[model samples]
Each structure stands twice: as C-alpha cells, then as structure tokens.
Target chain A: MAFSLLHGVHVPHRKNTRDMAAVRMDAPKTVVIPMSMHIGAPAKPVVKVGDTVKVGTLIAEAGGFVSAPIHASVSGKVTKITDYLLSNGTTVPAVVIESDGEMTPDETIAPPVVDSRDTLLEAIKRSGVVGLGGAGFPTHVKFSVDLGRIEYLVVNCAECEPYVTSDTRTMLDRVDDMKTALVAMKTHFGIRNIVVGIESNKKAAIKSMMGLMNEVVATGECTFTVKVLPSVYPQGGEKVLIYHTVGRVVPVGKLPIDVGCIAVNCTTLAAIGAYLKTGMPLVEKCVTVDGGCVKEPGNVIVPVGTAMSEVFEFCGGLTEAPDKVIYGGPMMGITVPDTSAPILKNTNAILALSKKETKLPKTTPCIRCGRCLNTCPFGLSPAAIARAYDKRDTVALDKLGVQACMECGCCSFVCPANRPLVQTNKLAKVLLKEEKAKEDAKA
Target chain B: MNTQLKLSVSPHIHSGRSTRRIMLDVLIALLPATAAGAVIFGLRSLLVVAVTVAACVGFEALFSLIAKKPIPVGDLSAAVTGLLLALNLPANIPLWQCVVGSLFAIVVVKGLFGGLGANPVNPAITARVFMLVAFATLTKAAFPTIVDTASSATPLAAEKATSLTDLLLGLHGGAIGETCAAALLLGGVYLLVRRVITWHVPVAFIGTVFLTSFIMEGMDATAALAAILSGGLLIGAIFMATDYVTSPATPWGKIIFGLGASLITFLIRYFGSYPEGVSFAILFMNILTPYISSWTRRRIFGMGGSKA
Candidate 1:
C-alpha cells in the first residue's frame, strides 16, 4: 500500500552498532534509580534506606494514574534515598542501592496471568513499562484508553536517531518476543491492524519483522503490515510515524488515539513481551553507547540506575575528556550536566562527544533564507516566530502557532546563519505559557 | 572527571554553514563572471572591481564602527555588494564615483536600515540606481570600446545589427559583468547547486522577460532573445534580484517578485526612456518584498487545505 511521506529532516544515521549485538553488563557497584522516570507524577519511594531488595522488587509505586512504578534493578540494600539531579536541571527523589554482588530475583517474580484486557494492562503497569522511545510516557496509560477507538497499532521500529541502534538490536535479538507481544495485543485488545514502521536503513530489522509477520499470517491473526519509512530524523516521532503509515494527522494538542492509532516503541513492546514471559520488570535497558570521544563504542544492555560513568567505562572509557554527554539521540537528546546521572527507563543512548563535536557554532544574524521554514516538520515559521518572541508580541506568537513546535531541533540544525532557532522556539513556548496563565488569572 | 561539560539547548550539533561560509560561496560562484568581465573589458575592469570591493568594505566597516555595531566585514557580504555594484557600472567610469556608489550602498541603503538582512532593498541594485541618477552623464557616456572598435552605444542602445554570438560571448559594448551571458550562467548554476540561492526567482524573472519581450515586439524572436542577453537582465536576475534579504523567502513569493520585476522591466525597456531597466525594476520589486511575502506565505503543512 502507498503511504504518504511525512515531513522531517534527513539527518546523518550514525548507527555504528547496527551490526553489534548488545552485551549485558553485570550490575554496577551502585545503582541510583530516580523516582520519576516517566512523565506525569513522580513515583513515591516505598523502600527505605538499608532495606534489602532484589531484581524486580517494587522499590517505588506509581504516585498517580499517569505515572509508572519503579523497580529494583540490582540485588542490593538501599544505600540512601536522596535527591538526584536530572538532565533538565530539576532535582527528583532517587533511591540509591548498593549492590550485594549476588544478583537475586524477587520471590514474587513469575509469569503474569493475562486473560483479559484489564489483566493485560495491570500486568503492564506492574511491570513498570513505559514508552522506551525517549518520551517515557507510561505504557499502561496508553493502553488504558478506549481500545475500540484504536484501529492501527503502530510499532515504531524507525529508530531514526543518529548514533542510536538499540531499537534495531531489540528487533534483531528479540523478534520472537516482539511477535508474541503483537499476537497478544491482536487477540486481547482487539486491534485489527498492526503496522511496523521501520526505516529502510535498518534492513536487518525490517527483514526480521517481515519474517515475524509471515509467521503471524500463517496463524491467521490480525492483518500485519511492515511499512518501510524513509531514513529521516524524527521518523520515529509518534505523529510523523502515524501520518506516514496510517495517513492520519493527530491534530494539534491531540493524542495518537484521537486518530484511531496507538504507537508503541519497538523496545517497549519487547519489554512487555519479556515481562509476560519471565515476570522481569524494566530492570535493564539496551543502550547504544557510541560517540566521537569513546575508544570503543557499541550497544550494551545496562541495568536501570547504572551511572553513566560506569556505562562509559564499560565502553572503554573516553579517549579524551568529553565536552558533552547527551542522553538519547543527538538531534533531540538532552545534554546531561554530568556523567553522575543514572540511566532511566527511556534512556536509549549515552553519547560522549568530543570538544569538536560539542562546540557550539558562532551565531550570526538571520539571513532570512527560509531554510528553517522548509525544514520544520510541523511547518512553523521559525524565523518569524523568533522575531515575534524577541519583540514580545504574544498575539503574533499565537497567530504563528509557536506552541505547535515539537522542538525536534531541525530548524536550528539547518539554519546556515547558525541562529539558535530551537532555543528561541523553546523560549517562545515558555513566554506564551506565562502570558496565557496571566490572562487566565485575569479572566 | 575534572573536565567541564557544556550545557546548552537540545541540538548540540550544527550544519556548520555560517554567514561567512554562505557569503564565501556566493563570492566563489561569482568568480567566473568576474574573471570573464576582466578578460573582456581589459585589466581596467579588474581595477574597477577591486576598487569598488575595497571601497564598499571600508565604508561598511567605517559605518559599523561609527554606529557601534559589530564589524561584519568578515562575512564577505560587503564584498559581494561591491562586486555587484562594480559589475553594473561602465568599465571606464571614474573610480571616485565607484567609491561614492559603494558609500551610498553600505552607509545609507544598508547600514542605516539595521544592516544586512534588515535592509529593504538590494544594496548593489540600489547603488547602481543611485549612480545612474547621480552621475547620469558620466555613466551614460562612459561605455567601453569593444576590442578597439569605438562603439558609443551599448548593444541594447544600438538595437539593430549586433550578432547573437557577440552578445552571448560578451564581446560587445556593455557594463563589466553584464556583458558575459555565458559566465553569468555558469555562476548562477554554481549558486543553484550550492543551495545558496534557488532557481525560482532567476527562472521566473528571465522567463517572464523572454515572453514579454517576444509579445511586445510582435513575435520577433531575435529581438526577444537579444533583450534577454543584452543589458543587466542575466546578472540582475541571477545575483541582485535573488538577494536573500531583499527577495521574498517563500517559493510563491519569489515567483511573484520575479514576475513583477520582469513586467516592470519590460514596460521600462519598451515604453520608458531607459535602454536598460533591470536595476530600476529589481529595486522597485525589492520595495514590495514584504507585501509579496505576506501575500504568498506558504500554506503550512497539515494546516487546513493547501491554500494561502
């Protein structure tokens, strides 16, 4: 079937570990699991300091319906419950566990009994599954939406971020588990159509997914389709993937389910599959650890809460002191303040970049080239929006649709003048929010 | 562990294409034409280009210093303006007049109006127009002698017996760079390939001129072809009319700007007194850029239907 091409920038796909199998690392000496890995409310710590816990132990429970629970990633005693600094510069409560050197499984760890939709969602929530595609939205909350409205279940295998191939590794290493999860979704959730959107760059992953689809077809399951998307940056974006595969636009401020679709990350599905089989919650993650500064770079399966410094050491420590270490893909990744931050549930890649790679380009005046306009996936006039923002014109900002910017960094990346368009877009959004709050208070 | 890590926004990487780099590309693309102009009009043509460029850069730096703005001479935008302004002038025109034109362009037309991207008109075209008005007798009477043949009038003014080959090869009497159609085309192609400029404005502008001249002259193909090849049409369309700051940013806006410039050019060439109308037409259209840009704002992706 012909799928419409979605708009996105053609970024360099530095999938250095596309062919490298992920090697599992033993738990670090200490694990610092943050209480707020997922969006919405932060999880509240239930385990106290010095309390003994094992892998898959519930260390923190969901603080709200939109939040996901946190699990003990190491067999250890809780060292401390302390405030941890996130990459975004906010402090969150984190439980630090000192490894006991004997990896033990929790006594309650066993295969989940899934007979109905409620049981499946409960099992998913219990497993602490979230969107492993970087946004970290709670997975059970996504599935809890009206299942009848979701017509297409899009498996986002299009790991289009540069220097990140963890999803590709998951698709190659966990094909059977992915198929099992898909079949479960088909039979239980009543999702009729399943679309696996993989970028053409990942030929091995696409081939493996297609093989799974054939096996599923033999069983006479729901219609399974593998949509090959162009290798464009942000092709894995929820809205872009939906538009390309299902030919539907999730209008501004609407969820994917609003367009009769539910998009799940490829690794997220693999996690769900693994949980259904082994009852192991999100304890470890397959992270692609490769960047310019590293001596040896490849994908490694790291336990959650492992310090980034430990991950870098496992990858043969930096050749030179890195100027920046980014979490997730280079395009939309957040630069961590330091390597002391622990890997979260959604952390896909930890890039240790050299000075040359991280040095900010000198900004010049905008030449009014309109390349930013042409490159923005959401069709925002970044140049005009920057002007409106600088002038503090709230009405112009509203009319220009500054709030619709996805902050994918395409505009800033492509600007020849090196104008900080994405930075200005972010500021514009904040300004608009502040103005709106003031108006609301007045009203 | 002691190394400090930089913390900024999301995009930690850039394409590294700077304003200086973009200006350098424009300069590189203009090399063939500048070389051709020098070769065709003798070593004096090179002196004209050099003086104008130096004068323009000096004026820009002086004005920037006086105005307390950052000296942006390194970006090579002033050099581009100087080269363009020099190319539009007669080879035998006085060097002092060239300096005056450069000063007018950089100081009044550009620097006074917030500099560079904030200017409302193309600096080179506005400067050319200024010189044409201020030094009318000198500019009109200073046409270069073509290969020792003393032809007083340019090919456009002569209007009767000039060969198309001479026009294409730029062997006839004209301004320094405007005479070489082949060289200008090569440079234009380079700019297009480098993505420094798009083909929309140049194609539409040249196409409109070709079509309008053909219709105006009652299907005279030679007249229409000569009209395009002669005067400053090629240089203006390829270089000045497509100035990133002065021209519209949207594709539709560029097309409209091109068409409007071509129509005015045709009107001035056929009905008005000037033999060459490229400078005035482009300057007039540059003034309407904001309006054209607003009217032709691209229909944003996934925003209602594909309509303005």
Candidate 2:
C-alpha cells in the first residue's frame, strides 16, 4: 500500500469523438502565424509584408539551434507584419496572411537524403517539427541526445487528458508514417528497444498498433512492446511515462536521456515521418473539439495558424455562450483571452466549457487530510510546498523538491478544501530560481 | 464565442468531494454505534445525544456571529463534535451537563483556537477529559432499567466484570457508545469501506494495545482479547483518536502517533489509579502532533535514496 504514493488519480476520459473519422476543413480566408510557438528563441521572420507565399514555403528561420522553423500553412499574401497577444500577457510578431482560395503546394519541395544520423537530425530541424504533446519543444533538439547511450525509444500515445483524442487518430490512421519514423530512428541510431505506451481505454488504437508492430519488426529493434497502462490522468507525463515504460526513476532535475531513454510523442514522430518521405513541412494539425458548450463534437483537420473562431465554426459552432475557452484539456490547458486568438503549433484541443461545468466548490480551511501528498504521481507534497511558499522560504522549497512538480494539477483537482495547490507549486519554482540567481550574483 | 470568457487557472473540474460531504459521510458511519447505545441504555441516552448536538450547533453559530466570519456550521463539523462528546458521557447524566460539555467542545476547545483544522488537540476527546475531572457522577455507567446489574467504574477493573459475552454485546456497564464491541466494529468497517479514514492509525494503536496486554497477562489470549474489547479502546482508536486535524497526515507519522498513544494508555491503565486511559493518552499525543509529523516527514520521490 505504500506504493500508492507513486500512483495518479483516475480522471474521466470524456472521449466523445474517438470513433469519428476526422474531416478535413477547407482553407479559411486568413491565417495568423506566430514566431514564438516553441520554448526557445523566437524564430526570425524571413518573408517581408506583401510577399506572396505558397503552402510549405519557409516564412521564418530558426532563431537558434534550440528553435524550430515556421512554414506557411496556406497559399496567401502577407497582409500585415503585426503582433499577436499570447495568453501570457506578452505580444509577439505575427504574420497575417490572407488566403487566395487555392491551397497550392510549393514547387521546390523535395525529400532530403537520409543516410546517417547527422542527416536525420538536419532533416528533422528543417522539417519545422516540435513536440505536438503540448510542450512544443524542438524535436531536433531531443534527437541530438547521447546517440550510443540511448537504449529505448518510448513513443507516448497516452492521451490521458479527458476530451482530447488527437493522438488516438494518429495511432489509428497514421500507422504507416509512425512505422517509417520508428524504423528510421532505430536503424540510424542502432537503438534496438522501442515501446509504444498507451492507456487501456483506447482498445481500437492498441489493436492498430499491434498490427503495425508485426510490420515494423522486420525493419529493426530489440523489443517492440505495447505497454498498456491504467487509464490514469497524467500517465503520459514525461517522467511518469519513462518510469512506467522503462522501470527507471529519472532523478530530480534530470531528463529522460540520462536514464538511457528518449521519449517522443506519437503525433510528433508521425509528422516527422510525413516530412521525411514527402518533403512537406508541418502545416496542418488534427484538433479534437468537444466540451460542455459544444453542440457538435468531433475531430477536424485544419491548417496550423487558423483562429479558434473558424475552427469552432467548422465543428458546428458552439451551442451557447462559453464562460471559459481553453487551448487544450481542462487539466493543464491554457485559457485564451477570447476565441479570437490564433492557434499555435502545439494546440491539441480547444475546449469551451460552460459556466456550470467550470464552477468550483467554495474553498474551506485545510483539514490536514493528506490527500494532496497521496495524489501526486511523483509523491511530492503540494500542501507542504504551499506552506513554504507562503513564507517565501527558498531553502525549504529546494529541500521539498518543488522543481519536480510537473504542474499536472492532480493535487489541486482532488483537494476537498479546493486549495489552489499546483498553482502555488509553479510559483514556488520561480521563487527558488530567482533565489539561486541572486546567490550566484553575490558569489 | 462570447466576449465574456473567463480565464481562470488549470484544473477547472473538481472531484466534488467537499468538507461538508466528508463530514456527512462520517456522521453516517456513526449510525450503528448510536443504535446499539440506544438499545443498551434506553431512549434517555438518545435524548442526551440530541440535546448535545443542538447545543453544539447553537454555540458554533453564536461564536461565528460574534466573530463576524462566515458561519461554518454548514460544514457539520460542530455536529460531529457534539455527537462524539455526548457518547463519551454517561447515558443518565443531566441534560445541563450535556450542554456544558457541548460548550467546552465547540466554543472553548475548537472555536477559540480557530475553527475546523486549527485546534492542536482533539476537541471531543479533550472535552471528555475536562468533564471527567469537573463532574462528580462521571464514571458510573448506566444500564437498562430492566437489567438488575451493579454499576462499576468501568468494565476494565470491576470485581464482577465477568462474562465476555456481556461485554461484547453491550449488556455490561460502560460508557454509552463504548460497551458494545460488536456495534463499534461494524461502524469501523463502514468508515473504512467508504474511505473516510485510512487504516494506519487505528490498526497500529489497537495492535499495540493488544500485544502489550497479551504479554502482561502471561500469554493468555483470552485475557488480552477481553482487555481490548472492554473499556473504550475500540471507540477511542477508531472514532476519537483518528481526527484528521490533530492526527498525523503521513503514514509513518500516523503509525508512530498510534504506538506512542498505546504506550501511555497501557502505563496508566496498568499502574495508575484510573480504569480508563484512552482519552488521556490521545490528548497527550495530540499535543505532540507537530513534532511527530516533522520527525516522520516522508521523503520526496527521486531524491537520492529509496523509493518514496
């Protein structure tokens, strides 16, 4: 029973459109592509205003080695080089492109030569691919990990958040692309082990992967296993996923590569596979649309820079006025200021929750029930973290492992007192980092 | 959609388990023991419980009104405190003493320290000890009018405290809720099944008491069994000592708290002049909760050594 601390909470998997095939939406009248989609230096705009661009045209170059490039999602004229406000209260330069009603592909597109590990990394960097699992980290940066020391390729298909099933479609409909990407990574890096991690609720997607596994075995690998974990919320969390699939505990402040594993999302790998074979960069995404205020719930394939208004209308626009419109699942989703905000590269699902659906209970005094300590998959004590943060005790914050908190929101969701626990954990991490910066300056 | 979009934080959905709902579950779990107490001591005990509950709720409302805070009577914690204090009292005690005990439990022990989770001691258990010293007719256990039995200080130390069946069945002399081992065990199972309480504290406390008594009785299993089943050990370990606010939240802390409590309980009952030591032992542990919790703090995951 002591092992229960490492367990996560059970979240309701509200997969309303898991069985529906995705419908490809037509190009909208306009698109707004932002430069700072991933967590690195913002990409620099390469195309000027009034420049004519086609789909897959390079509009922005990588600002640094840690950044990714951006491509035009539709054939259009660059109307304005203005700024777009993000949810973090800061604005970044955005390219407003008005479509020409004809989604034309660039004529100069051609697949890159991929004979070795160096070519694979360069091709991935040019493909404009990032983590599609909502992190938006540059995919090429992850592939450049310790090459020979890597033991397993853990593909995360665990779409554990409720009302989000974009990865399920990737597993069901894009297996060929996934298999090609897996085989390419395995043969180039000589990594024998590959594990596709999925939850038990998606039976159809598991069966499809099983069929694809038989075909991928001939290409190369040591063991190809489908680890079906329990349908727990945050099962796909990077550390939790690595621990569940490879049976290794990534130490505090350490990456998965330190433990001989390279974790990548299933959709990110499939996008890379498509780019490697067809020479087309990432321009479109399959978004899951469903929530309490939605009249019609399904998946739609739309261009990457489309606005939430156009995407919602494509899914038979929201039924009623939404009190909250988030950019992903309800657990860790970013709430946009309004529906007029354009989608980013890592936008997986857009939810418009009604007022009743998002209503939280009145907060009461803490009863010291210990549920928050028990609910965290990492066994971190959110209650104690909140106490230390209130006092601004940086020394105590570091001792409690506040940086290990993944902001999964499990403790906040299960608190009977309705304490804003995870939010406090996030603030505590920032405070500790500031303290370290000040100490370094003094030294 | 609309311009009136609310931009709150993550985790918009909740588990729907409020403090009131948890308190409601606890109140429901205490039903079987209340019924057995009524059957053993007659309807007069029920009247005492009702008066005590009403007084507790009234006093809580009064205190909150005076303090100009949002009244927490809606959380039902006051009702729980009253019911617990009443059951620990003698069934035939005067109704005015019931009111006095309710005041001590709510306004003095609980509300004065700040309501709900702020008290350093278990309010009901502490109030019971206060009454035991302040009142004269506190130890004489009440029996049904039909049974011609002699009342004693407690079933633990009486000359006529024979017949294990009478002790288990609540036909002996004891507190209103403590006599019937069978009824209290049923209620304990209910709380465990509903997950209102964990098993660490109750199991450790009861197991320690049983083991110590077994060794003291020269390895006689029957005497040890009778030792635990008598007195108020079951009610104290399961219901009174397991209060969330005063008890330790970590697993190891809870076990240590329980073991320390059993050690003191056995010392007093074995050597001291009192026949019952459960309430006093719990009060002592409650005072040491902060130190115990800090000493037994759980290690975070991925922090160097063993698995958390």
Query: Could you give the interface RMSD of each candidate, to one decimal?
Result: 2.7, 1.8
- List the DockQ of the predictions in order: 0.57, 0.63
Q: List the residue pairs that clash in candidate 1.
A: none
Candidate 2, residue A365: lDDT: 88
Q: How displaced is residue A309 in candidate 1, in Å?
A: 0.7
Cα lDDT computed for each candidate against the true fold: 0.87, 0.86
lDDT by residue (tens digit), candidate 2, B50-104: 9999999999999989988799988899999988888887789988988998899
Error of 1 at A316 (Å): 1.0
As for candidate 2, its clashing pairs are A192-A222
Query: Best TM-score goes to which candidate?
Result: 1
Q: Which candidate leads the pack in DockQ? A: 2
lDDT of 1 by residue, B217-264 (tens): 789999889889988999999999999899898888999999999999
